[model samples]
Target: MKLNLKQADTEIQPQWQPIVGYPCPPEFEPSTWVKLWQQPNPYSHDEALLLCQLTEDEWVAWIPDQGETVLYRYQFFQR
Candidate 1:
C-alpha cells in the first residue's frame, strides 16, 4: 500500500481530489483511505493473482461464486 508521492502531488492536493469511481463518501477522511489500503484480505485464494491487472492503489476482492468486485483507493496514489 505504498503511495506515489509524485503522482499524489499531481493528482491530489489543492482540492485533495481522488481518482474517480472509488467508493469514497463526500465526507470521507484521508485516514480512512489509509486504513482501507492496509486492510488484509480475508479470502484464501491468491490475492496477487486476483490483482494482477490492478495498480497498487487498485484492488480486486473475490466473493466466490457471487463474482468479484473491483476497488480503488480514493485519494491514494498508484504505487
Candidate 2:
C-alpha cells in the first residue's frame, strides 16, 4: 500500500504526528505495517478503530480493547 497524504486529508486531520518507534514483533511481517491507521474513540475510554491491509494469503484480525474472545478477521477483497 502507499501513503497518500493528500488523499488522507479528506479522511483524517492534516497534521502529521510522528509515531514513537517500537520494535516490530518477531511474528509480524514488514508488510503488516503498510498503510495502517488507528483512531481512538472519543465516546469510549477503551475503544479504538484499527484499519489495516489485507492480503489473499493472509487475513486481518483484531481483538478490540473491550470485546469477546472471537477474532474478527477481514478480507481485503471484500473492501
Candidate 3:
C-alpha cells in the first residue's frame, strides 16, 4: 500500500483506515486517533510513504523517500 501525502495534508480521505484488531497493539491509543496509508502517486506507488499517526502531535511514517520509518511532517495536517 502507498500513501497520498497531499490528500492527507489537506483532508482525511476514506482510504485512511484505522489500524485495528490484532495488528494494532493495546498500548496504542485505541487505534482511534490515527489514520494510515493511501497511494499518492500512481506512477510511484512503491515509493510512496506509509504514514501513520502515533498521537495528536506525533506522527510517524515509513518514508520510502528516505528509506526508513521516521517522522514525516507536512503542512495542513491535523489530528
Q: Estimate every model's Cα lDDT from 0 to 1.
A: 0.41, 0.33, 0.40
Q: Residue by residue across 15-75, what tens digits does model 1's lDDT show?
A: 6767788876443222221223432355422222233226645656443433455556552
Give the 10-residue window scoring lowest on summed lDDT in candidate 3.
Answer: 27-36
Steric clash count of candidate 1 = 0
Clashing pairs in 1: none
The per-prediction tally of clashing pairs is: 0, 0, 4
Please name the candidate that would achieve the greatest TM-score relative to the true structure.
3
- Ranking, TM-score, top scorer first: 3, 1, 2
TM match of model 1 to true structure = 0.23
Question: Tens digit of lDDT per residue, candidate 3, span 1-79?
Answer: 9876664456645686676664743433322232234433444223323355665545454433334343333411223
Give TM per candidate: 0.23, 0.17, 0.24
| Candidate 2 per-residue C-alpha lDDT over 1-79 given as tens digits, one digit per residue, 9 for 90 to 100 | 9876664445655896556796543433322322213223334223222334245344343425442221133212121
Give candidate 2's whole-model lDDT. Answer: 0.33
Stretches > 4 Å off in candidate 1? 1-53, 74-79
